[model samples]
Target: MTNSKLLEQFRSFYFRNFPDDMETQINYFSIFGGLGWDVDTSKPLTQLIEELILQNFDTLNEKIEQLTLNEPNNKRLLSALAVGDRKIFSAFKRAGLNNGNGGGALNYLQEKGIVQIEYSRESEANKISKHRISHKVLFTYPFIRFWFYFIYPHIREIKEKNYNKLFKSIQNKQNSYTSLVFEELSEVLLNYNLRDAQIISSGSYWDANMEIDILTVTDKMEIYVAECKWTNHRVNKSELHKLEEKCLKLGIKPFQIILFSKRGFSNELKSMQSKDLALYSSDNFEALLKNALNSTLIKSFIN
Candidate 1:
């Protein structure tokens, strides 16, 4: 088969293996072409991930090492980039890099498409004005996010070909690391399904004292604010109340409030659901993807 066709088959196999989870899809693809027809599923998922990382260590390291060679301070910048929260230029300065050096590294990464720059305005009115533009750096791909989060920091051990400590570190922090991926998936669901509204902008929103997980604004000035919980337990009414409190504090009366949970919702939240409130679980995500697949736009384009 041709290269593109072979890649399509791989994507088909990957989705079949990890249909419901974005993080697992990313894990599988990061070790590209490792999964085959005789794939073993009996082992722990983390073990599988570790094995794949070890198997691809040389390839991954080659790319990273080339980057380091090009820019001597790239590894230091990668260490700073591994952080969970959004960062500005000043944050990198605090991380011990000088302003000019940090800015240059950031520009280089953006140019290379390894990182994306998100400019946040205080309000829609200020979008044209450059006074309050804030920059937030985000990874362009989940594999890069995973690498930076789990593997990049342990470059010394990786260089020594010692993976035991790295595996243990990943095991300890995998859930926390994948939570961001789950939130991004939730944002995708919101973007695809928010029926009447035209999404003008969407992303994680943060001010000095508050952070909103999934925030979207429609062209009609409607706001859809959401929280994504990637936990085993059901999300209760208290979490909804907490969202309300945050909205109140931020002076936002969202047109719709959405809650995306991994396990499901509590009995209280189930009873409280209404036109303005929405609760979604994995099944909803499945339905959303199914609908997208069967959408007229997709079908017509494919034909």
Candidate 2:
């Protein structure tokens, strides 16, 4: 199959696999894809965005609220979500691309009133702009932040261009990349568990210097630390040790350490599983994805 065709297939697979707000998410993924973000796409990025926003306005509103809560300061967060946190500036730069005419192919939906933006004036260098969905009827919504970061920059190579090197780069990251997506799935599951377990509080923990992935706190203040490893290599003792060290620095009791690995754990690690810690593999990841897909609450939202 052609490269674009394959991309389309992958897009379809992802949409069908995790169908919640599929079109909007797919468009979000595509915008990120075109910007060199991590997203599966099989069609023109702009077209995808256009179709999704035009088709669904209500669902887009919900995301807009989530994205827009504390305006002006959270602009960076919005940018980070639309694009990968690593490459958010590119999206920002693209906002003024056409001198406000959508010329450079990376126009800001915020400018169009589909997504709203607010600017902060704390520091000139640290200026912030918060974005939200402005349309109430759900015409089209902005894409997710991560999609714009990882998937949107490589559109040229994906659009009938001969770029083997580019394709290889994307392919190499696919396994671990998808693993990150699974990690996101896991977070949702953890949130559900938190509610079901009647845990009062949960907050994500991360160090600017190091990645902690997740940190959940219970009503009793018991902290559960999770390290999400989206790597092809199996989760092992050394990996667990790294998480332990970080937890120590956080000053939490470390009620449990969970490792979410793309490729399961090593035999040695498997032998070491205990109540204090556990390892979850891609198989479990698949189950999580399936459950999310089949969820009654989310069924209508995605389709």
Candidate 3:
């Protein structure tokens, strides 16, 4: 499919599945003056949210505070009292911390049992801490996160009645925005094809020293290092060389290398498509998603 067509389908799916997020984003932004957290109107929003975050902690001495003090029963109130709510993350991002406040809020939620965190068996290079909202707050938290980070900023355009341009911008950059989701999806899909591939453990990993998108460790200790590219371009050999050198410097691997692209592989790398080196394209990915999401042919596909 053409990139534009692909993006349209994805956006349709996202909106369909996440209608609440759309509503929340619109509502929040409208209330806070177009999601511009730096604006004067947002000052109250930030101060109020920081106070909420502070309520979750007990005077910095580490004593557990009264969890019931805020609303005592309302999930929304509890979320408001916690540190990593949409408001706080917005404040942090506006202050130039980027995703820092969002990350901190998520961590806080995990600590409060309002959400749960899990670690996968995927290799150290790719094993990421997967999070799920506790059943009580599942529908609410993700929508809140999506609102403040994804949809809120676009509020300005919507207010100015520039929806066509807003939608176009979202359409053009959708893949890059959702790249992390696709990377995780790719790892889950690859497991079925790796039966004879000596994979001891595989998962999404990220840390200070190493920042691999995906890492698969073979039983024989060979490491498969991957770089997932969501852009519309062929995967070239230089990227492979870069990944190979990175793995070598980390003191691991008679490396198995794979370059996964949303488009396809470059001509220079096509000749090397073998067991040891591999390239996967967007068409292949669509098939994987179809097989998993359509008929349940792949029972192990992670949603």
Winning candidate number (TM-score)? 1
Query: Cα RMSD (Å) between model 1 and the true structure?
Result: 6.7
What TM-score against the true fold does each predicted structure earn?
0.79, 0.53, 0.51
lDDT of 2 by residue, 1-303 (tens): 012221332243454434344333432333332222233345443444334432343455445445444243234334433433322333344343222333212234444333332221123333235532111111022134332333334434434443454445445654444444444445645655455455554434433244566676667777777877766577788988898888676556787788877667889999988988877764453332343343322111122
Q: Please give the ranking of all candidate structures by lDDT, highest first, separated by commas.
A: 1, 2, 3
Candidate 1 on 1-303: residue-level lDDT in tens? 012222333344444454346334533433333233223344566666656666667776676666455575555665566664656655475457777887777778777656677665456553444444456776555555666677777777887888788788876876566666567667767876765567788888865456788889888989889998877689999999999999998788999999988788988899888879999875565533453332221110001
lDDT of each: 0.64, 0.45, 0.44
* Per-candidate clashes, comma-separated: 0, 36, 11
Residue 56 CA error for candidate 1 (Å)? 1.9
Q: Which ten residues in a row have the lowest lDDT in candidate 1?
A: 294-303
Residue pairs clashing, model 1: none
lDDT of 2 at 138: 11
Winner by lDDT:
1
